[model samples]
Target: METELNVYLSEVTDDGLELSGTLDDSIYGFEDEFLKPFAGLRYELGVLHVGSELLVRGKIEQDFEAACSRCGEDFDFTVKIPDFTASFAVDEKTEFVELTTELRECILLTLPTYPVCREDCPGIEKKEEKAPDSRWDALDDLKKG
Candidate 1:
């Protein structure tokens, strides 16, 4: 349920239209226990109409609460696209260009496949193996005899 991101052709000016806003977390429609949205998606973009193409370029950022892949601990995470850019095909009769799907995909693609709390996060601690049972010593004696 991504929020509609449409730029009307008439809105594009010679200096390019500047669009900046924050969309609800529902825009992602991400339903995962391990990865949860912590904040809304924020975008600052410039829209331009060039020939038969609509160009959208700018920055996109979103915050999340993700579980560490190795430690299974929850941590804050942020997905940022500093140089987000996309071009859509349009025509003289086209009214507006939709950028919701493209923006969603871009954010999703930027997310880490295996998120970690930190770069040097030590994984789950491993327990030391216990010493062998003394009861096995009798069996060892029987075998020696």
Candidate 2:
């Protein structure tokens, strides 16, 4: 279903409005080199126009390309929010409600703080043990004697 980032208050009915669509990747306009949006956000929301307030509830899904924090390997990540919800205060003058920014933040806030490529990732390579110092060789010789 095609959907816009904003909801027109006039379209709302007593039975509420159901919105389902994929918000374009442009919605995430902020700059972050590390995290790249893989695809547009898919959402299914229910909008209710109550007294002095507009309530929005639905599910949101987004895909992202992220690097593993432990190994620095690139990976795909999917964030799903089944109970996504928000509310806004409105009045007679409120013509439309902006949904892009809030939805973007919601997905970002749900992202993993330290993402990993996999659970079994071993991380960076470990260095081998060093050979004994020559100074300690003399002590070993004395012990042998």
Candidate 3:
């Protein structure tokens, strides 16, 4: 889902900009056999005029369901991501590109590589032990002799 940023950008002033929005599951694409749809997201974006540059700051909060990597239990997990970046739009012609890249990178970095259902989840059960090979026993006897 392409989130609308115009509202937030329009509010930008000498002081800063304040933006609020709801992010649905569509934007995140958080799909796993174990994870269910994430709840709606709440976020704020603030843009400030620094000494000679523009600074972007944002915070997002959302909840998602995750399954234990080892076990198969499911649990709810909350993610709150806070990020900031400085842009030199006055001096750099590619300030828009840099800002976009920074935001994307921050979002990716905030996500977890592995979301476990619980910290103490027990992994899958082990299979029953099998009997030792007869050949190994014979080899042992030969060595003893």
Candidate 4:
């Protein structure tokens, strides 16, 4: 679902525009199992018209939850994604697509490669060693013969 940026764009009296909106799970797809049980995303977009170019700036803040790589336990983490800015030539066809792609890319880039349950989680426990087979013992005796 596309969150409406029309309000901000419509109010562009000057060359620069400031846009802010609250984004819940409904629009951002946070209800998926991987993204649930975490905080919501809040974002702001700023657009400026410089000459024939449109400069876009965006910021996002949210929390994420994921299973730890080693312990298989769940963990909650927060990511304050850095603001992103890009320039694009204002055109009929490419403006919206470029902005949407840039937003998705920025969010994905901010995510951690691997999330841990805790800093000190001892990994999956090692299993106990098994005793040597009786067949092996018999084979040893035969070899000694």
Cα distance off (Å), candidate 3, residue 84: 4.6
Name the lDDT value of residue 92 in candidate 1: 85
| TM-score of each candidate structure, all chains considered together | 0.82, 0.80, 0.60, 0.62
lDDT digits (tens) for residues 1-145 of candidate 2 = 2335899999999999999889877677754566788668999999999999999999999998888888787888899999999999999999999998889899999999888888888776632456768999899999999
Q: What's the count of clashing pairs in each model shown?
A: 0, 0, 0, 0
Q: For residues 1-145, what per-residue lDDT tens digits would candidate 4 score against the true structure? A: 2443333333444756776655444444445454443434556877776556677777866667777777666678777766677777655343342354455456667776766676777767732356777878888899999
lDDT of 1 at 9: 90
TM-score for candidate 2, residues paired by index? 0.80
Off by over 4 Å in 4: 1-10, 26-39, 92-98, 126-145
lDDT-superior candidate, 2 or 4: 2
Name the candidate that leads on TM-score. Answer: 1
C-alpha lDDT values of all predictions? 0.86, 0.87, 0.60, 0.60
Clashing pairs in 4: none
Q: Candidate 3: minimum summed lDDT over ten consecutive residues — where?
A: 90-99
TM-score, structure 4 vs. true: 0.62
RMSD value for candidate 4: 9.5
Error of 4 at 75 (Å): 1.6
Find the number of clashing residue pairs for candidate 4.
0
